[model samples]
Target: MANTSNKVREFQRKLYLRSKQEPDQAFYSLYDKICRFDILWDAFYLCKANKGAAGVDGVRFEDLNSIETSGKLIKTLRAELVEGRYRPLPVKRVQIPKDNGKTRNLGIPSIRDRIVQMACTLVLSPVFEPHFHCNSYGYRPKRSAQDAVICINGYLKQGYQQVYDADLSKFFDTIPHSRLLDKVRSKVTDRAVLRLIKLFLKAPISEPTAKGKSRIVGNPIGTPQGGVISPLLANIYLNDFCRKIATKTPCKIISYADDFVILSKTPFNSAQQDWIKNELEQEGLKLNEDKTHIVDMTQVGNEFDFLGFTFKYIVGFIQHTNYVKIYPSKKSQKKYKDKLRSIVKHRTSLTLDQLVERVNRVVRGWKNYFGKVGYPRQVFFKMDWFLVARFYRWSRSRSQRRSLYLAQDAWNKLHKAGLVYLQPTKMKTAKVSR
Candidate 1:
């Protein structure tokens, strides 16, 4: 009976906190009952219950309408509630939350923005420019391939060239918050956070929504936008590096945000590589040496895959592997070959299934024609066969959904012949219908 009494009291206290109302004897009793188990989740449940307690009793709804200090606090509270950060003291009602549409708010500008905007515009503009991501992967590579050709053309005009690839070391974490906030102050006109920042030093911090809740320790990651000046700050850092390197002669440096590639026409000799390495070290960015490769332009092909496109140091000589293995394990070989044939048929509306009886036949044939010029995966011996089937489906035409297999057969014949030479012409349309 004594144990039961203690339990009841603990539950009442927890319930009181959760309710967000003034602590009363009854609430304390409930709070006492809950803490007995000593489980951590019970603490969260208690916190959730306490969220309902925030109140404004004497202040009437009409008083809240006035656009003054109280009104701003209320607005901030409302915003917090919508963000799932606000909790009233415990309440009995369980209801699904609704999204109250609010216009997006960009915060005040800071020194960070000023710095970044200036750098990208002034220092980096001469060399690397922002590149846009294409919508579709299919046509994108071919276009990017063309762009590589243009880069090669530029190199030839300038002289001989060497390329070095780089990535930043903890780029985002190094930004200064106070400097960032300077930018935020100008952009953010939101009634709440702005007001908070304005009177921050003097303001009484409401008890943290829960114990141990504190400000974020490091810079945030993976957000589209931040308080106001994050992008400007980031771009400024990029520009700073660009400006320093601008003075360096006889080489070209290009960057897409942090991923950078440096090109110089000098020979792939040790002196040129060492010179380029020292220049990058002067800036904050570091090159990932293991992934980096020096392409010899004089060799068979200079083409390599970077950021996605297969950039041939030469263009036509470089080959890419397709997903399906022209020769998989003995068990899956037939299946893999069939799928590749399906994709080829779908491409040109002609079937070549009759010309190939085994995986070896298809493997030997496509390599002879396309070589390194196939899809992202190679149909090489002992490769994953299931990938080939997937590629066939992915490459199939959206219009041919109704008769995919039939379309595949048709595509293969045209692909092989490079012309509309469908053998057994009457049977072609017949196979499609069935």
Candidate 2:
């Protein structure tokens, strides 16, 4: 099983290198690669492993349980692709609330569609991954948000004393379909593959109504955020932007999907910033002027936040020597703490065991993510402190008003319930570098 799992997808690797070498050449008949049984087989497992909710079609992973059943489904999809009979279903539309009191729209594709998308992305990623700029780090294999943060740090330490934060307004929703399709056509000339992709691109939406019925509506632009291929498609759409900023711009640029931050030796004034905005607009992208700005890092006490980490300078205690400091941004910390608070405060009706289990899951995941960079140990200490107080209050609320030893009793009760929290430390913080 281990060997089977570890086996390389050789066709993908070879094609990856081939596309890397000849990025401009459009090769026809590449659709057959995605239709390979092995590729679909791997994609089936990937889709199963993800275990997401059923899409607009209501076909769940459990519906395709065994090897034979899963194989049949894959073979059916392969046949549909080979014979040019595949039809994409309109994705299920869902809305998620944002931190800024707005809701972000997501489209959930069917399970079978997800498998196809996965298979396509697995084969297609190799073809496009090599051409993507090093600075573009979202949704790519191996690279991560930490790598993007590391990039900014590298540029900052190398005397890039200015920061330009570029916010693309409604980036995913505003992508020009014709332009994106043209970009894809430049290299991916296979009619079948292109057709399948276009089918997805033009997929309408199945939006659920208040009466539990769903309505089908046209989606004229943008990829659905929740679909498996959305991120890859987003990267493809902005591939030019990545190449342009990384090559043409004088400033150092690091991006995660639509979030671009420019590091420069000289600060960009309003005129230069507007010029940059015009250039991006020419590429069919627009900036959110409200959230976009530049910061001159050479000046004392100037800093910026990127990818949940704050890039600023610290004054050393012994010699007053100054150096760059990277830590979990305050916004990130507050959001994490609020999540923790919500779990305990709202769920106090549950048993201590149940509440602690829920809380522990969040605490562990948060620590693992924020612990990647910076001295967040102090931050961890504060979180644990905050948790203790919240738990103590929760414990107090559960007890009798007649209890004489409230503090000690609550402490003892919390200990007995086996609640988990971070252990504060002064040791060296874990760091990730590219």
Candidate 3:
């Protein structure tokens, strides 16, 4: 069983690297492998339980079938794992020898607060169109590569139009650690907190590893290049920057993470841009110019991506297809069910009727705000589709009465988007309201 798991990990890594190169083809291949693996793993588990082989039971032989059925085994295996009852694995702690008799533990929040105060802020530009892609999980759109282009064009539009863009020297390492620490100490007047900050400065360690090699660990300092908290932290810092700028001049700051677009109505001026750049320099962050651009109105494209939603030149021209859809898979229905099961497992006490109330709550909000925007079918997104389908199934699966609120919000949202028409679903306990 361990060996089988190891092989699965190996395949996942190789596939991950390959997918980075050829995402489209690899997505299909990886998706198929995951599906097939799930089916076989389930079969093997049932067979082993019947055979009384409580342990390994030579699951590797079945796993070897991973590449079979056009790698259907691998696909099934991953899906099962994602949906399986895997317990949280224990983490290994590393011991680092102290230089003297004292060691300090710097709490990230303490240091982060200080970073925000001392660091200069940057007001990024607003997202316009074609700059971001959709993420179904977060239920938000993300910036696309072209969005970067629009960012530069936005700057140019305001008259900081420069023909050249440049990169910073030692962008990441140049952050002034000593100054940052000092700033942190000033913000939090606790001695113990200061001690922690002091220790963190001297003992910056690589991120904690959970399992497996080749995992990219984050460098300390609360900046997760791609983690959830990173954006919030960056936003805090940038907000301070914008406040400072707004104090001295007029500029609006808008951002989705590090990517920024600043609007200055003060005419096309390099001085403001320069001052903005200088402020960022004080804190260690720098803009990459090789990727930056400056374009006039003619150069401005009609669409861009910002804040996860695609912006088109025309009002109400958001392309929902790029933002929401069930992922490509043969067992869409089953996968969707598994998701709902997990949701219910976590929320053990929620009754079907209560769930109905909750979903309807969100639906009510949708109706009040976006009710008249588009057709009911267009309103519901992939998230709505999956959630609604799951709740409907759950209501039927359980003999006890279940509520229907869970599906209500998603359904109404989907309906407003013109994706589906109004349909009444019969719940166990009561008649679910649309």
Candidate 4:
């Protein structure tokens, strides 16, 4: 362990000297530099300190953080990377329940695996970030689902005729391992790092069965869904796909990870879909036919949901002139209501104040998100009323014969006390002129 520490210190000193000599270059130019003991330790510390979970190995962050074992652990990790003896443990598969009575499978990697992956990402992402399309928002810093929605909204407001929403079917799971490696290799030349990533990609997965047994299965294709490095790799792999669509077509592509919304002045024809299908097939990816939809944004009453914002072209009279109002969708209202109801249902054990606090948190965040995109004032009012009714029901169930006034009084009290605040009614609208 002492010898490993000395070697790590020497590597750091050499890195510092090289940086001084170059002066303009980024520190640690080569991929092998990422395998240094201190770098791995720092990466491991960051992951463990942030409460990163364990994988199928059952090695917890706390175990890695232990003073008695951390040195040995770091030493072993360094040796594994340097000697190319690293083999990723099986991913722990868990199913998370979604809103639509469906389950999303998430793959949890062990802390050790996450540390190595994160270290590689720390080195590789900077090289990849500048190359990603400006329209692609998935997994990029300072870019988000809302940003994708905003970009699409901007194009629509600028008179784009239609929006075609498409998502890849089992995107992470279907990405061809060899193809992804080829893409990564095209940009990153670090042999050791590449080998480690290969191990992660080809690692078998342990899926939990309904009968409480675990099944170990080989995953020949696709990266693990929930692994730390998965999103970055997915972004890199799809960067070309996005570039191809952007360069060959007039349509603008806005991607928040695998979810893609193509904006154009004309509707997508079968030929365009076929082209996209063929492009995706080349990389061993396919579109989810069930989730794909094409909506003409120029036509009145036409609407589509993307990145949680429902965009619709509503014709309205503004000072005797008919103009289209591209506003947040009604579906957003229903979604928010369902979310509030779910919160109320699950948090019944909380006190009235605690419950109000929780509700306010959700309301504030939801309002901030949709509010930024010009969600209607009426929707905010509807949300407040829904909450009022929910509060009344909660009060009624707790105390027999609690009057409507009592519930209303409590609602008003929460607002007055600043425990809860409704979204403002006079928010600005992003209406487009015809």
Candidate 5:
């Protein structure tokens, strides 16, 4: 572990130095190496081992796993790349059911498609990672929704009064392909690689309809919703917009993909709002007017959900001032509860150990996510109570009538066994709790 840590630190130091000296050289070298047969073979094997899903071509990982088959596959891919005849297969579109009785469309790229995308990403990431703005935390390595929330909290601590929550309407789907390609062309000049990217972008698509018909169509604009490279391209395309906003506006913007919140010391004037709207429009993007609003955190005092976190200004009685408090949003909490309820509802089908294992899995994950927020003790207590209550309810519903002590005991056993864990913390001293 120590050696690994030292190696990582050394690599980071080298990358930092190289980025300062020649920004594009490192990426160009990596890209050149990645295109080599040995490196591509290694990448292909890695992708196959990860069990990447097949694309519209229906080429499974197993078919490409063997030495003989992988060699043939690599040769064919290279030929296609050299001849500029490589075309991404149509993405498999599927709808995933959401909790709100709605379905979200997901595009599944093929195994070969993913292998190529992953190889490119591996080479490009080191170069692009440093250029991404600190405020923009979407689809980047070593960052998450929580990082954006934490950034916003840091700004709130510095006396931001209002937060303008901006939502991009169909951001990914509406990105003009020409504009995206223009941005890509600025950074990458290799004709063959550019051709490969163009092929990926302009690939034909087929979406299944409700009537069980496949509608073949061409996507001349927006990136494919579920393609491996879409998020990376989106980030690159939006980086310019984010840079422009940082340079021109007085507001601090925190973005996670299409969701953005602009924090300002004062509410945005009409001109400022128009400037933002116009900037996006120039990029062929539109703001979702219904979801965009300037919130006065001090006045409203109501929690606003952003990136799964509930952000609100709570009065600090101890300090006699306002402080931003973050918690798991009610919607997220409800989902957790609903999942637990489902597990408890089926508790009779499982053994005691299995039931405890399931509960512990859920609780541990919940704590890992929400425990970082301030004043999580009360929330943890509530969750504990909820679990105990559900267990009792499940028992009583079946006329078993388990004692409250027994139910509590079961929870305590899980808690003590290190299955269900919450952060140990003291309650806040006299503050408005929400």
Candidate 6:
């Protein structure tokens, strides 16, 4: 462990220093570095440790959990790469239900391919991290949604009047492979690395054909959402985009991958919006017209939603002073409330203690995601109240229930039953250096 960890750190340090010293300097040799036994092992553990479904190849983590089997697999993978016989297979396609009654498409890579991707990312990430947008907080190391929210909160406090809510339609699916490779070539001149990336980019999709027969079809142009390297690749593709906005626009932008909103004192006019649209189209992307809008903060009743939270100016009746506050959007709240109701309803067969345990698990997860937002006290309290009401009402109606518990009694009973209750918390402003 010590030897492997030290090698990984040293390799990353070298890549960072070299890339930093000569930003545009291209290297023709990186394949060997990426394929090193130590680096591949490090990358292997990275994939094995994280939970994911098997790819189209149907290989799961349990199949390769043993150190002996995993080591042999890595060796075989390295040999294939060295012999130039490596080819990534078509990705498995799956859809997940979104909150808006839609589905999000995810493509799963084979376990072997995932290891190679992780290996490549482990070597290339340090070289590329220095060049990505500082304010872009999605999917990067040491950045989180909380950091992005804090940035927006600070900007609003500084009196940014208008929020330009921008949404890229099918961002990941529409990125032009040619353009992305060109961007990659600007700094990464390694032929082997480029070839591997191109193969990954054009990897076909295994999808249902006629009569639902599964077959590999269509050369996908964008990064697969489930690939280990997709986030970094996406950031690399969008780095130039951030620069363009800085150079050409009057607004300051903060982006979390595809979801980005620009803050400015003045609203973007028709011409400016058209320019942005044209810029996106030239890159094989388009703006989502339905989701794009300019939020005027100066207006009394106007609010705009960004990154799952709705930002609005609230005026107190006593002091009559306006201040900026944000909370989970109404859509998000409703979805969560429905989720809680469904959980309690679906766990009808479980004992009270078992049901409470399941609910607490979800409550903790929900709190982790939404609890840190600005001015979430009232929202958190309301959510707790809603959960309590739903659970107790359902409990009292149960035929096997012992006693009819009052509201306060129900709270105490649930507490005694090990139910985890969410408490109101003030949002902490996190500072990130540019």
Best by lDDT: 6
Model 6 steric clash pairs: none
Cα deviation in Å at residue 19, candidate 3?
51
Q: For model 2, how does the per-residue alpha-carbon lDDT over 35-63 read when each residue is reduced to its tens digit?
A: 88887788878878778888977888898
Q: Model 2 has how many clashing residue pairs? A: 0
Off by over 4 Å in 5: 1-20, 23-32, 37-85, 97-102, 213-215, 394-399, 402-418, 423-434
Q: Which of candidates 1 and 4 is the stronger one according to lDDT? A: 4
In model 5, pairs of residues that clash are 54-110, 55-110
Per-residue lDDT tens digits for candidate 6, residues 157-254, read: 78777888888877887788989999888888899999999988899998766687788887657888888988888888888878788777767778
What lDDT would candidate 2 get against the real structure?
0.79
Measured by TM-score, the strongest candidate is 6
Each model's C-alpha lDDT? 0.36, 0.79, 0.37, 0.73, 0.71, 0.81
Candidates ranked by lDDT: 6, 2, 4, 5, 3, 1
Supply the TM-score for candidate 6: 0.90
lDDT of 3 by residue, 50-111 (tens): 23211112233333434464255335434443554212111112333333454322222221
Cα lDDT over the full model 5:
0.71
Q: Candidate 2: worst 10 consecutive residues by lDDT?
A: 425-434
What is residue 8's positional error in candidate 4, in angstroms? 16
For model 4, the stretches where C-alpha displacement exceeds 4 angstroms are 1-29, 41-54, 59-76, 319-339, 407-409, 412-418, 422-434
Error of 4 at 238 (Å): 0.9
